[model samples]
Target chain A: MDEETAKMIADKGAWLCLQPFLDDEDAIPFPEGTPQRTKQLAMVAGTENAYRLAKKHNIKTAFGTDVLFDAELAAKQGKQLAKLQRWYTPFEVLKMATFNNAQLLKFCGPRDPYPGELGVIKEGALADMILVDGNPLQNLDLIIDPTKNFVLIMKDGKIYKNTIQFK
Target chain B: MLFLYGLLGRAQETAEKNTILIINATVFDGQNEKMQEGMSILVEGNKIAKIAKTINIPQTAQVVNAQGKVLMPGLIDAHAHPMFAGISQQAGLTSQDGYLNLVAAKTAEKFLMQGFTSLREASGNSISLKCAIDQGLYLGPRIYPTGPMISQTSGHADYRPSTSIPYDPNATLSYIERSGHALIADGVPEIIKGVRSVLRMGATQVKLGAGGGVASIYDPLDVTQYTFEELKAAVDVAETWNTYVMVHAYTPKAIQTSLGPG
Candidate 1:
């Protein structure tokens, strides 16, 4: 079935999810003008290799934060990815971690049936919200360190945690 | 002071150690290596410390000559239904439910006698049977167990007559009482819930019916019961629980559709 699908698409002169193999040792190509591709890399935060490949292939990539639970390793990868021009913004990264993933899995629309003005937090939306202390928009690191910015969290009309600190 | 003196004195008085010597035996080490030529094996305490070509007899040593026997590492049967009663269940012979533990214990012993020192039981008599065997409450092979086979409704495990409702309460419990298994739910949500329940109950691997079965009245032999989305849901549940999902499949369509591109 995979081969059949691949052949059908290839016969039409279109390829989904193109993975590039390069002969050059150091150079990774920048794919032009939103190159049509998607990449799913597992153990994403565990290795910088996937990021290097993602940049080379010009594919949009998403990662779960499970890799690099080791604090030192996470910092190392964070530093390495910062040098790349195609590196994802922290908010874009968070979107990939949350909403982009939900989109890929088709989880947030009519089939999901909980649309609140297009998932970007409009008023009169079903407020299934996560409130973190610091700003996740500033850095993905804020997610792992709740004490730095997260003051409270409410979900479905319940206060699971309210860690407001008055200075 | 008296107790300490007595203990020291007792330790100083040496008792003779008994020796056991077995000669002329073929031995197979657990690591798949074999030895021949009737070497004598010596055991002191629980360990086999000495193996020699020849040993002069000590008067105190117990000697036995095994001239014609083969000794292999205890075999471990990876999958066995120890409580399955060996019944071709269609015959309807009183349903193996009577004295299930006793039967399972005996079955475990039979497995041991067949040189299986370890057994991975998929689904069986009950948790009690496995617990008994594992806790040394009974003499049987060491068993790593799954509590019951979790089945999706009207799938391969919808083991009920067409006349009854799919969730016939009496029939469901009766099946468990008889076969030690259960048919859980029908759709994706129910299937995921059932998988979670089984995993929480200590099933290391969740068994799913990806295809129809010989006994299933819901679909025919070639028909696929689970959709790709449902299979993904099941896989997600299994993944979150840190276990594997083993789907029961008999047809290519079932395997292909359920496991395609996942």
Candidate 2:
């Protein structure tokens, strides 16, 4: 492992995007003895290895989920993020998803449809953001169930959700 | 009618008050590593006005006491089929447009209530549904609609009966196809035309069935669909419209074939 090369890539603002939650062992529909099962196992190993390498080299990381075909699974995206708790600290995972991912999106350059700054809050940054009910840094699992934990959601300065009405 | 109108007008007047102050909350703020405890957020109109431990709360502004609750961003579903309602393919052949739209609307509301603020419609006809939501005629999440799933004959998107002949004028279009849910195109010209038609209908992206599926009657899971030339035509049309194509493929061969043309 080329530690210098990994550090160079990190310095160049490259992000190691990982989706460990996509490696759902139980979701493999194939029979246990089938070749498809073997392939699924290999995929799980690959995902774990990628995460390990990124962490070992202190590489910049980003979070995403490649959910498709199943609506039930699609709604479990937050659970997928929580699954990362097996490998990372809650704060590290949150930073990877928010700060690191936003930095990577900037690489889109001209193709970036959203011109405003994202994934952060500042005086002039984009108003797209969220507010959770629990301290996620202490308990990452709180993010797994958004309906119960997410008390407020604001996008582009508008409050789309507010469970506790002040009126 | 006059009395009802007056009540609604008053309700709208109150709902239009956009200043909101959320206080005594633990703020995630999306990007920050540390959570700010006992913070206050002031939203003026649709934008966040201020976030501090203290802010001058306007008398007219709505004030929400967070009580140390966690506040975060709404979730986003990257791949969602809001139009699908779990009916059998054969049953879909008999379903009407009204029934399908109602089902889609219900699904959309479910998504919104579940805290999903945005959805990327994967492989269904949802442009009209998206429009209805955007126009405030329906309550749902923001949608990035893919008009329809394009597939080759006997591909994953091919939900037609086995007895139906290919491109036969005597045989009417399948309910799914007629309802703008999927299109079966065999050749490059047909693929290009189908892609363009969907793009014209305000599709932000194109979804093509580039592989077989378990639910599909004819195509086996291993079989690859859509030749390189055919896939290229769809890609070309999508690129012309400043969008991209997403192919539904499980097998490596199908994925590789789809990647070949792009």
Best by lDDT: 2
Q: lDDT of candidate 2?
A: 0.68
lDDT of 1 at A132: 40
* Per-residue lDDT of model 1, residues B1-262, tens digit only: 9999998876654234434455665543322222355666554432344667787765656565555443222323334456653333342224546555565676665444332334445454345766675555765554545556556656665655556564556653555524545545667787788777766665655566676543334655556777787788877887776555555553436645555524
DockQ of each: 0.01, 0.24
Q: What is the C-alpha lDDT of each candidate?
A: 0.44, 0.68
Docking class of 1: incorrect
Alpha-carbon runs more than 4 Å astray in model 2: A1-130, A153-161, A165-167, B1-9, B85-94, B166-170
A70-149 in candidate 2: lDDT tens per residue?
A: 44654566777788888898877776666555665444344343455665555455555566666888898887787888
- Worst 10-residue lDDT window for candidate 1 chain A reads A34-43
Error of 1 at B20 (Å): 8.5
lDDT tens per residue, model 1, A1-167: 13333333334332121111122221122232312111111112213443454444444343321111122222222222222224566545444433333232222123221233212222232222233433334445644443333333322222233343311
